[model samples]
Target: MNAENDLIKLYSGRILSLAGDIPLTERLAEPQATVKKRSPLCGSTVTVDLVLEGGKIAAFGQDVKACALGQASAAILGAQVIGRTAEEITAARDQLKAMLTEDGPVPEAPFEGYEVLLPARGYKNRHASIMLALEATAEAMAQATG
Candidate 1:
């Protein structure tokens, strides 16, 4: 399949799976720590909320007003991060950066879901939206730990 088509599928899949219009729409949450990131190029914004327990993520959620790519990225991040440790989330963020920037090998298992975003690598403008969730999540973890 073509890159655009693949992106469309990934975007639609996540947007369709998105639950509860209020949180994502109204941007409401009481996160342990919140990190907000914006794609200056496109004006897309993604704010992530992380609740940590025992050095692991007890919950992961986000409020995003952006393109389909950003929404899907957030969904994938939320799904993989819950129950994972801060270290694990950091590793995933690095892996995601590598995948998008260096053509690195895709991470295994849960992160494999992010493979759909690989095509986003070629679209430089879309990179910010694609990485927004991960960056914010990593920052939130850092704030929680420190």
Candidate 2:
């Protein structure tokens, strides 16, 4: 497909709509861990805060500063991140990375919503921005658990 086609698909209505409906848009009063990831390529960033209890996330919040693609990803993460384990978040992050760069299948449920971003597979430059939320999430999870 041409670049225009790629851009059109990448910015579909569903993604643009999802981008505006982000959840967990706050900072926890006292988080167990917090991580911020930046896409130097796009100057997009996502800061994730987590509070874990009983080996699962009990509370979550995020400060998302990114493009539509990144916001869409944060929306997905915000939807399912609570009550999930660090390992689960890490797996989803890995699956998303593979889906973008290695021709892997969509991530499993909860995070399955990431399918909206499949068209981004062809745009290498946008990959980092698209991944900001999950990267920050996974990193925050790791710090929270360890």
Candidate 3:
């Protein structure tokens, strides 16, 4: 297949399937912290709300308005964020940034679903959108912990 076809298949297949795993499509009733991040490149946006208890995430919700990549990222985060400490979420965010910007390996287990987006490293335009979820999550966690 041509490069373009490969990119399309990568975006349309495993990356898109991850979107179906997102569970926090609605806003939380009473979150301790909330943060929204937008990608200037594609105008993709993600808003995350979270509650923390004993330094770990106790509840979470999100309003995602973005491309398949962004949605999939949010889905992966949503699936694994509960019970995670702020430090863990921050590490995942930093690791995701490295994976996208520095051609690093996918994040560790629990956040490893991001491996499906590895093809995205070659598509710079999609990076911001893909990072929105992790960025928003990190910000929300910070707000809760700060």
Candidate 4:
């Protein structure tokens, strides 16, 4: 397919739906950890804040400024991060990276929403933007757990 067709396919209905209803748009109050990630390629940025409890996320929030791909990624992360442990988040991040960089399968449940981003794998320029949220979340989790 052509670039236009790729773009259209990449911005599928599921991606648009996720982008339209980004959860955790507000910053968390008194979070234990916070992190911000930016994609130099696309100027996409995502800031994440969270409070940890018993080695798992107790609360989470984010501010995302990016394209539909990035927004969808943040939406998926925001929707499922609340009760996940650092290991889980890290694994998801790794899986997402693999998917984007190596043609791996979508991450497991709760994170399966990342499937919507598979179409983005071919668009190298959009990779960093799509990864911003997960990278920021991983950093925030690390900061909290440290």
Tens-digit lDDT track for model 2 on 62-140?
9999999999999999999989997898899999999999989999987999999999998899999988988898888
Candidate 3's TM-score: 0.94
TM-score (all chains, Cα) for each model: 0.80, 0.96, 0.94, 0.96
Which TM-score value belongs to model 1?
0.80
Each model's C-alpha lDDT? 0.74, 0.92, 0.87, 0.92
Q: Model 3: number of clashes?
A: 0
Model 3 misplaced stretches (Cα beyond 4 Å): none
Better of 1 and 2 by lDDT: 2
Please write out the lDDT profile of model 4 over residues 1-146, one tens digit for every residue: 69899889999999999999999899988999999999998799999999999998988889999999999999999899989988899899999999999999999888998998999999899989888998998898888878
Deviation in Å, model 1, residue 65 alpha carbon: 1.1
Q: List the pairs of residues colliding in candidate 4.
A: none
Q: How do the residues 1-146 of candidate 3 rate in per-residue lDDT, one tens digit apiece?
A: 69979678667766667776677787999999989899988899998988999999888899999988888988888889889997898889999999999988899879998988888888889889888988888888888878
What's the distance in Å from true for residue 132, model 4? 0.9
Regions of candidate 4 where Cα sits further than 4 Å from its true position: none
Q: How does candidate 4 score on lDDT?
A: 0.92
Better of 2 and 3 by TM-score: 2
Instruction: For model 1, state the Cα shift of residue 44 in Å.
Output: 1.1
Off by over 4 Å in 2: none
